[model samples]
Target: MKIKLRHLAGKVFLSLILISGLSTPISAQNLISNGDFETWEGISTDTGLDKGIPAGWTSQTGDGNLTLYRTGTPHKGNYSVFARNTSGNVSRMFTPTLQPLSAGKMYKLTFYTRGKGTLANITLTENGEKLNGAVATSPSDKNIFASPSMLNKEYNNGKEWEKQEYTFTIQTDGIYKLIFWPKSTAGTDGETSDYFLLDDIELVEFVDETICTLSEIIVKGSTLKEFDPGILTYNITLAKGAAIPKVTATPADTKASVKITAATKIDGTEPERTTTINVTAADGISTREYKIIFEESNEILREGFASEDRPEKFTYPNKTNWIIDANAAQNNGVFFGNNSIRPKGSDFTDDYFTIDNCTSAGILSFYLKNRGDNANAILTVSYQKTSDSNNWIELKTIPDSEIGTSYEKISLPINSGEPVNIKFHIQKTAGLIGYNIDDISLTPFIATKQENEKTGKDIVFANGNTIHLQTSIPTNYTLYNINGQICTTGNVSGEYTLSVDTAGMYIISLQNANGKSVHKIIIP
Candidate 1:
């Protein structure tokens, strides 16, 4: 009994430990700002306030007083510290007798003051050096804070609270004293000191919890409309949190889609975290989706591709590829010659044609049909996955010896995502230079085992001439075989596995005489 009790206790302790390890919660960090004056009591040089002045604030000896105003409610209120000069020497200095400030972060300074003072200047100094470049509103009024050289303006009157806002972006990160000095050398004349009413002095950091962030998106479901004879567009929104999150996306299947991904950071923050995914179909249709994630390093956007025109011809620093003549000319030339490259092209063609549905993955098929008497043509095709067009690698070079008789088919396999641009040239290797290109197609090949669903009965076809019918039929429909022959037909509009004993190419057409129309399918 004693041994059993001990064993049970040990098992219970081990279980508790395992549960604690598995249930660890994610750590949370403080989003609110530090260096705020809510907790300043004891006075010190490092502290941002001084109690001797007014609420730990001290203004220069004068008839005017710097007021501390609070906006909004108690715990969630905004405080503004201002200096108002009623009548005295135009010089003013109000220093916080407690709590130091943290540099590098941005701080908002709001204040309002109006007086007959000739000149006014609010100098924010740490130790003895001025932190920010001075900004003077009333320059002519020597009794007010002097504006900076760039902002050469003077205050008009010393009454009424004139609103003004200032943002201080600290360069160096550290703790330092914050002092507000408003001076007017206007001297001790009968003129009263210019009024400088201040308010709403609070320091807080911005938290990015409301910025837009992209979670998950489907391009097919979000298409807006069909234009350009069926050019569909899809625009999907993302989850924009306080700070927009950056994004990087990979398509599940490249054969089904062609897309480009990009991201932008939230406003007033480094390293934009919002991403935009652009998708363009083979029919020259395009759409975009945005995704948001944390920040990271990436290339800055210099320019956007022109989608209106097909890019068949490309030049260096220019990422355009041409598969056929576009009749478009480059700088100071009409013919295609390689020069001026992103990687700096030299002695290259100036004219080129861009292939529609071109991709950098798998294999791309190029059909070059012999039109002219050119037996062996010299054509050079270069491709790269980078913006620098010069970085492109030569894919295929058809010398005078490799051109075969009759129509020839060329296949080039590529693995790239950077160089979306490609350049091509057809030259006389030995004999001729004319060849017509037709049926240009880009096919992305994927090699992966597809798992079969529901294992039970098995049906096999001896001949390779298997007819796979994929249709969207509504009700009862008839499926006809080759030579106007009707073998087996069904009404279902789903995956129908049929067995055909014959070994030949068959054309299967589905027609509902009383319904919409006829659908055709070819089996080889």
Candidate 2:
């Protein structure tokens, strides 16, 4: 049932837009040649200064050295890299050939650092013969940092010089060797006297408009919290024949796609209604959008997800072997990096961590800890009985019985009313070992406010294309659809019309014996 239908052909509406195209490729250059350090060489003519070779670059060990070049402290012209190791060194730097990338594409690097002492870390490798560069710090599977604790600090003790950048993508194509390495944060004693500087260093080829989406959009118990993912517009009032809400969007690059196309009915003459959701990335055409209006209002939505950094939103590009672990956690603190990636280095991955939105959400708790031998770990959920109808049905899995080895607590169920996306997956091969997850949560599905005196508290929303219901008492009213059948019934009190003959989703219940109330509608 899809045709022309622009602006409202008969009427029915919904909202959701998680697009992130990032199209901006008019040109490209910057490969890194001497990057700012302004190029320098020589021993300042026999050690008068200039001791850290910075003219193009290379490093297996310090050849033609001059003290690691600082030239009094230049961030732009003179020179940078102030390094100085001794007690078992490894000072690195490479960048010369490059120019191959292009498979999947994306790039971007930029640089600048500070940390004159303590933990001055940095390190990023390539030269792919197999990628994972054997691991340097964190984030992997293909290009996510890979190690050194997921690298990202620009240091701030030498006072200033921060400026970082990341972007990444370009999985594999060829011609490698990039490595920058900077080190120092481990156990100390790289023979003390360690310093840090580095300079501008750009790198190019980008187009990652970001769009991590689903900032905060609750459903079922309602609560839009002003919706503003950078002014994509989100409104949300509902009441007058209410029922036209289903705005689930979860795309932070899972190949990304939501292309906006949901509008669940309801239109008395339109007080307000809008729809839009066109998230396109993964190289289809680079897009972005998210509208969702729907006004009217009488009130009836409780809202969900409490908040407390909300588990740092789960981690890395938002859920992906969800790293963080901080050595280990069950309650000890840092959680994530699960599916068993233990006592070897810190964490490992196979992938799968999703956790998006979740409206009526019925339970999917967390905290597990299997070690291997296939202890089992997989939980899926994206269901949708009916709210705006995306028909997403996976319902349940939570198998492997419940996994074990250490941590516990694992809840599972998840019925779903609207925004719901939950994944866990865990598989191991090459030797085995996988499991970890903590505090994860979602228990919503309780909306029960209650109020009915006719022109005031809760239930009202009456207009046409039929969706009229008042309520003072009289009770006895039922209208269910979305598969439960029973389209209509009688005996409501102050008002009633609800004929939603076609389009989707509806629920209207009234009670008499002193209490009972419910209203959910949509009929564009």
Candidate 3:
């Protein structure tokens, strides 16, 4: 009586065997030795072979009607078995006897193949008797198996290499051999130029089927949190106005499949969005799902210098003299993103960039680093009111003593109630090395409402060229002219008055242990 067995296609079949749980514990070990076809014996020369055969494999060439040789063209290794038919007679290549397979235990045989014309027929045999059904039963000397081929034409004929796999279970326990027929009567009639190539063969026993996980998840235009197969949830913060990201998810197992679902709308429509990725194991039953949450950031302006083009909100008067170095990270110990800006030309010259029309009170922050050791290297941060664009007021200055080779964050408070323009100036006194800047960002200032309430009772006003202040407790004060230059700073108790030399709009900052408050005064 014929043994009953099931044959399934490719990797999907492997997954089914694993999920079916018809065998003992699963083993990743490949039962076929020299499966990669890397080692060969019986070679006559470097370029050609005399009856060359792969180790652990034997061949029947029908008395040279079919030629079997080692070819450099391979799917993965240095060589693969190449078979060419000179005559229509059948020729075969047989795998060494495999370890005994138990009845009721599922097994999978996989290999990569590509060629022209009729390729080959695959069969499982025991003691030279067909185990899986056979294709040919005539020509007593040539009829080694039954009739009709197992591999179909759709899978065997193609210019590009294709992976093929077969899964089955035996009815009895015994050693078995896998056979490849280059010209089986069951296959299409062979031609003189018909050829076939084979490599990377594998045989394994299936055990379990619950592998439902993603090996990788990629979101275009954004970086996802570090991926962990065990972690199914992730969060990403996108810049405002950024396009919805495209996601690609890859399953951990080749036999498994993945599907990704992304947000249908743009960012401004919703504050937050969710993208889901689903993975299904080869068994078509075991499954897993992952989620990525995207939210918009609350920054008015942020520039990392990740590209060559200057930011739209910024103006560089000497554009050609500036350099946006792409290899900042390798050149300097610290850098933000991929690039950083620096003055490229003559030393001791001023290189500056200006941000136009900043309308809100905010905190301006950026990274600064000096590449040279010159003591005269300096950076000046300044701002100008929109009404008086010609007059710039100095906010802060960073000298070489404070600047280091590594990047450091510099933050300044903008207390202006009117629109202003911000500027950054860098100067290097005596060397080619200059200052590098990156990661500039402006965030809206959050006022201390409670502190403002406590200081509300304090009266501050200006008349003529003098400013007057009355406070319940001792307070420290700093005065800045519209040009952003410091006018005066002092500590006072009860009442205080300060005189200024010029007439313009001035900013007075009063501070005590409770908090700080800023006031605008017009000096005539």
**Comparing 1 and 2 by lDDT, which wins?**
2
Q: How displaced is residue 188 in candidate 1, in Å?
A: 12
Better of 2 and 3 by TM-score: 3
Candidate order by TM-score, highest to lowest? 3, 1, 2
Per-candidate Cα lDDT values, in order, are: 0.35, 0.48, 0.64
Over 1-524, each residue of candidate 2 has an lDDT whose tens digit, in order, gives 11111122322211111223343432467776776777767645323445657777764433211135545565666666665433233344667566665655666666666655322223333454233223333333332232232233335455467665654555446555455544432222232223466677767776654434545444332334455656676655443344665556666666557665555554543423666677776566656777776654222221122222223223234343343443423332222112222212224424445444444554444556765456344544344453545555664445445666676664444444555555555544433445655555444422332433433544645345677665566778766554434567788667666656577655555556654445556566
How well is each residue in 1-524 modelled by candidate 1, as lDDT tens digits? 00001123112100001011111111232211222224323333312323323354444533333323222112223432223333333334444432344544444444344443322344333333322222223222112221242122355544354545443444444433344544332222224333333443433332222112223343222111111212222222221122232233333223224344544543324324434454433223333343323332111110111122222332423334322232122111111111111111223333344332233343343445443454344667766664554576777776546544344556454545332555566554332334444323232322211211222111112224454443344434444443334566566455465666655533332334222222233344
Clash list (residue pairs), candidate 3: 18-208, 134-147, 135-146, 135-147, 135-148, 136-146, 136-147, 393-483
Best by lDDT: 3
Stretches of candidate 1 off by over 4 Å are 1-52, 60-90, 96-103, 114-119, 128-162, 184-195, 207-524
As for TM-score, the candidate ahead, 1 or 3, is: 3
Model 3 lowest lDDT segment of ten: 10-19
Tens-digit per-residue lDDT, 102-172, candidate 3: 87877777787766634345556664653221232232222222223343232344556777665666657
Instruction: Arrange candidates, best lDDT first.
Output: 3, 2, 1
| TM-score: model 1 vs. ground truth | 0.28
CA error at residue 299 for candidate 1, angstroms: 30
Error of 3 at 88 (Å): 47
